[model samples]
Target: MMSKSTPLAALAFALSATTALAGDPVTYQLDWLPGGDKAPIYVCVDQGFCADAGLDVTIASGRGSSDAISRLAAGSSDIGMADIGALMAAKAQEGVGVTSVLSVFNKGPHAFYTVKDSGFDSVADVKGKKIATSPFTSSNVYLPLVLQDVGLTEADLELTKADAGALGPMLMTGQVDGIVAWMTDLSRYTGQGKDAGKEIIALPWSAAGLELYSAALNANDAFLAERPEVAARFVAAFKKSIEFCQTNPEEAAQSVVNMVPELEHGDVLGSLNDMLGLVFNDVTEEDGLGVFEPGRLAATWTRVAAAQGLDESAHGAEDFVTRSFQPGGEG
Candidate 1:
């Protein structure tokens, strides 16, 4: 007694389901507010790379890695971009079911910036100087290690907690002797200094022996387990976007500005070029972009374990990272 229309309705429903399944929905979270440093990701979305890969992508800005990781664990986002060190800390403390698939910034960007007139020629000179830093920044998290390496201690400097945005203006106005932030911020701060006719000097934490991995692409474990092909497509699309950014710097910056029109185009371009060195290096030159070298990752884990007070054997390097998704991504 079934009506003939029943079969037609069932066929229409099946076709709609197939269309929905064709493009998996993905929500991506960022480690911090949108900026030129995040151009590759914006490029991927604006250029329809993710859509072409059969992903319906939604991008969200993060306060920091802690916030991003928490969101991913809570199922708020399927994937995230965050600091690898922050990811390590989360995995060590809470055993969050999120792991990074691609390492974007091989070189850490933690550093201190001071006007040349501050006479802070090296990390040694930072002692007794007033420093402004946001507790959220990766620079502050590794400040102890950098201090230890430079033969100083937190007690040696006068630290002031401030908003990340306020730190730059504070430094430019001589409100603080130095500002602690990432090297990507260095160019922007330097540009701020130039506007005021003051030269800014960068004393990198790397110089103080606090090298570690920075930003990366991370996914919720369940998402990877259930829809790995979708995740792999995302990785592949992102890889292409990073390559685009490397070759077409101005266009990449413009793509980001296209998404975030509030940002100054020139500043975005300048900052994008400034941070390029951190993203592309010998490791990237040998193994393709977004691929991490085993040795370097091991070294980074040592720093992460020490920073988080986790035992090395308990949290070996492999426990937190994977290369299976990278496939032929190696250069």
Candidate 2:
């Protein structure tokens, strides 16, 4: 029967259906396997920040920064968290469709690790010494620039390319004098040292005047262009999640563990604490979270372009990033 309440019920149903379809769905790709480094993304999901922002975000684990960027460029992911420097290098090449939306790490984590008793006083000590590194590591892509920064050349060191899993064991067994790795991996080698009764020493390139930006939040061009508002909402939620992680790292680490149940609880917490220090610093303190300094970004682009032999015109840092999506206005 044609009743008035029937029409009202149908109208309400239609509205609910429309609302349900309105939330944007996005795949948030991580640069590597779930760990402390990825706590903020987990926090955003666990705390309902992404849902509150009208986003249906699905988190995906990644192989590495290069692999993450490749997937994003191939249009498999809407957004990605990865090594911004590696992304810059990829954007320099043809057929990539990704851009930076926010900066996650203000400083690069690239460093060389050696045992304290190994007698490496500084980066110079790496000269004429065998240094192990995985070919897939982002440290390999920037090794030339790092060596240059220390006034040394590749010829100065005996380099060995090995699997990441083999690096710590090889170093511990004295197969290599030192290993090139990200600073966050210190906890790993530290644990190994504890098992072997040795002390690990880190020589971060930033301390040696080769400062570069590391992991960043990125979005593919099509999604960023087709749905600007969705991107902004995601950014706001991410910023809130980052703040939560900074304030309550232990809880945030627990959330990450809940997502990646295979991860060790203490290891995840340690890595989360180390990553947080890189996430918040003098620049973030002044500009707010997820903000990047234009000057620093520009300088970083110059160095990266030179290192990768990319055309400056094609790899303009300005085009690779947009500030309108940050928490406040431009950072």
Candidate 3:
């Protein structure tokens, strides 16, 4: 009485039903090589938020911001973590699925460091002086525009390619007069051969009429459409993790050190504390953590487009964001 196709169809239905019951697996690629700098993500993973959300979230390290963006564009990553600069660049080229869901740094931390005795009172004073920088970062190019506003050009100084570590010595030892770095970076370098009376002039990027957020959450399109619920849960847990970090910084730092062990650049607690101060200050307490307002962040996208020559890039907050996964409305 039972037809062959009917039995086969029933079996297929049962198998499909079973698969649906299984949790969706996803991997999140970090914007940079994992370290204390990525403490919040570790906190999220260790706290079991990913598991609670029915997502087997596997967080892995990326070569750099660009590398992370590339992987996110390819759908190789379900949720990709990266800076707004890199994400905007990716959106320009491929019309990718990456959309911002969280803002890691509410304030930009970038500033140039100079010894107080150097007689540099402001960001504009380093004309004809030696400067150090890590190339390809938003700072490398944006600094030039910033300098132009103060009547200084790249030609006014000898620019050397360098990282945060090399920049300080280049200053203390007099290799470079000043370096484009961050305030938090200066704090880290204070004990490592930092001169006692060497007061620093902090050149905040925000003062130049430009406010930029450093890190953010970007997810692949396939994931957004097929698994919106999973995305929302992860964001929810990520917000809680941030809150936990803000309230319990010392514990958060220790937790991060436990999760990642390859960090050799500096003390785990120091970096974790410093990074937390930069991204997760108590300002997130009111509306909740990792909150990104579309209107507030649209300016950042515009800045990214202008810097990367994205003349043809679709430049709308809508193209790259869906707040349905965040708090308030579940974007």
- Between candidates 1 and 2, the one scoring higher on lDDT is 1
**Which residue pairs overlap in candidate 2's backbone?**
none
lDDT of 1 by residue, 184-278 (tens): 87678888889988999998877677766788899999998899889899988988888888899999999989999999888888878867878
Q: Is candidate 1 or candidate 3 better by TM-score?
A: 1
By lDDT, the candidates rank as: 1, 2, 3
Best by lDDT: 1
lDDT for model 2, please: 0.84
Model 1: runs farther than 4 Å from truth? 1-22, 327-331
Off by over 4 Å in 3: 1-24, 163-165, 195-201, 264-266, 280-288, 312-314
Q: What is the lDDT of candidate 1?
A: 0.85
lDDT for each residue of candidate 3 in 1-331, tens digit (9 for 90 to 100): 9887998999999998776655567788887766566766777777666666666668777877778877887888888677777777777787666787777776666677777667766776778788888765557756766676677778888889976557777777777787887655645665544454455565676566556667778887788788887777777777777777768766766666667766543465566666776575544564455767665567767666766778634567556667677666554
Q: Point out the worst 10-residue segment of candidate 1 by lDDT.
A: 322-331
What is candidate 3's CA lDDT for residue 262?
62
